[model samples]
Target: MVTRPASPSSRARLASARGTPRPDRQMAILLAAEKLFAQHGYHGVSIRQIAEEAQVPLALVGYYYGPKSELFHAIFEHWQGTIQERLALLQQVLAGPPTEAFLRQVVEAFVRPVLVQRASTEGEYYAQLVGRELARQTPETHRVLTEFFDPLAHSFIDAIHAARPGHDRARAAWAYQFALGALLHHITDHRAPTLSRGRNQVCAPEAAALLVDFITAGIAAVMPLPSSLSPSPTASPSPRRRAPSPSTTSRRQA
Candidate 1:
């Protein structure tokens, strides 16, 4: 056979013809998978479905992530990392005197990151995913709450307790719950009908301040004084037994 050599362009074209996709395509697949998984529960979605939504090869899902479970975990990890970065930045800003200022900082730290994400293109979708997972109370979500969320809540509780010395632990816990409930509801609901009807409004930064103020006042109002610190009022002496009333005794003797 007559020998033939491949031209540089031909070789380059051959390489280009290979099935490998660009990095952005892989990211699109992941993003699509996340949206689907978030919309439908993990068990409700399939790799093929994600591939179709992402417009990538069906096998690409498994190629990028070994299994559906891995892919699910990856999506959560990615969102959590983004949130944590914002949290870390806020924490740095909060590292100072423990005053109302610090409390405001803490509140902003907790709320701003998630709120900012809520305003992004992916934020609403991802937040819905988080809400669904939270509502379902899945094992993975529970683990994330325990590992990431609970610690942050406890830290805030401790800070509040310290700032208000006489605050009872139970009351502090309740106040923390109140603050968290407000934030959670806002995120899950996004002040929809309430704001839509002009009954309520939610400004991200201002809401943070309001939550801190509401929680701090609630804690201050309900928290009981420490037992050791509470002073007992002096009681008035009871009427003297009258020593059997000397005049009455004398009359009885007569």
Candidate 2:
């Protein structure tokens, strides 16, 4: 048979073609890692297991992520992007006039984006992962949580303060924390039997109104001095003299 030799250019082209699968393989590893991490806490997972789940070469996980901690951090960084996009939408809503009427809008802005995603499979998994991480409270996980949450909480405090200027800084911070606790419960409590018992409900539009009112009232109650400072409530009680005439009339009748 007459044989043909491959040219250097052809060999280079083949080599380049062979390299194209690398990125796809890396992405597969990440997706597998995310799923595994979601299902099993970080400590429960291993790189070898992840590589097997991804069906990629065992070396690729270390090559892409360096270590399991790095892989977890990468996943967290991806989640941060999603959080930033949602916060940006919230910021736009907050830029408008801040009023009691806007309180529900504010709550919805903070909450709806997260709750809306619960319908999707990936979102459900991600939410579960976040809950698990919070429960775990590993140092690495705590760092990620604080890094992701603290700024958002501070911004929310600013928004609350802007909406109710009479509120003091401490009270505003407390209100923000309360609002967050409520939101966190809503997100993490997937099996709240209280809902079936009619004691609590999640994602109800009325619950939005209830939250706005509850938070507003709680803040207002805690910061009563704000209202006390207003002229309407602070007006001095009209002074009254003793009814001397009535005493004299009673003495004369006796």
Assess every candidate by TM-score: 0.66, 0.67
Give candidate 1's error at residue 68 in angstroms. Answer: 2.1
Q: Rate the local accuracy (lDDT) of all candidates.
A: 0.59, 0.61
- Candidate 1 C-alpha lDDT tens digits along 78-147: 6776556644754564455333344445556656677777777787667777767655556666655555
Tens-digit lDDT string for candidate 2 (1-254): 11123466754654553455456776677778888988998889999999999997676576567779878777767667666765776677665543344444555566666666654556666676776776565777766656666566565555556555555656767776677666666666756557578655545545555655666566556544345443354475322111111011111100
lDDT of 2 at 88: 79
Looking at model 2, report the run of 10 residues with the lowest lDDT sum. Answer: 245-254
Which stretches in model 2 have alpha-carbon errors above 4 Å?
Answer: 1-19, 135-137, 192-225, 228-254
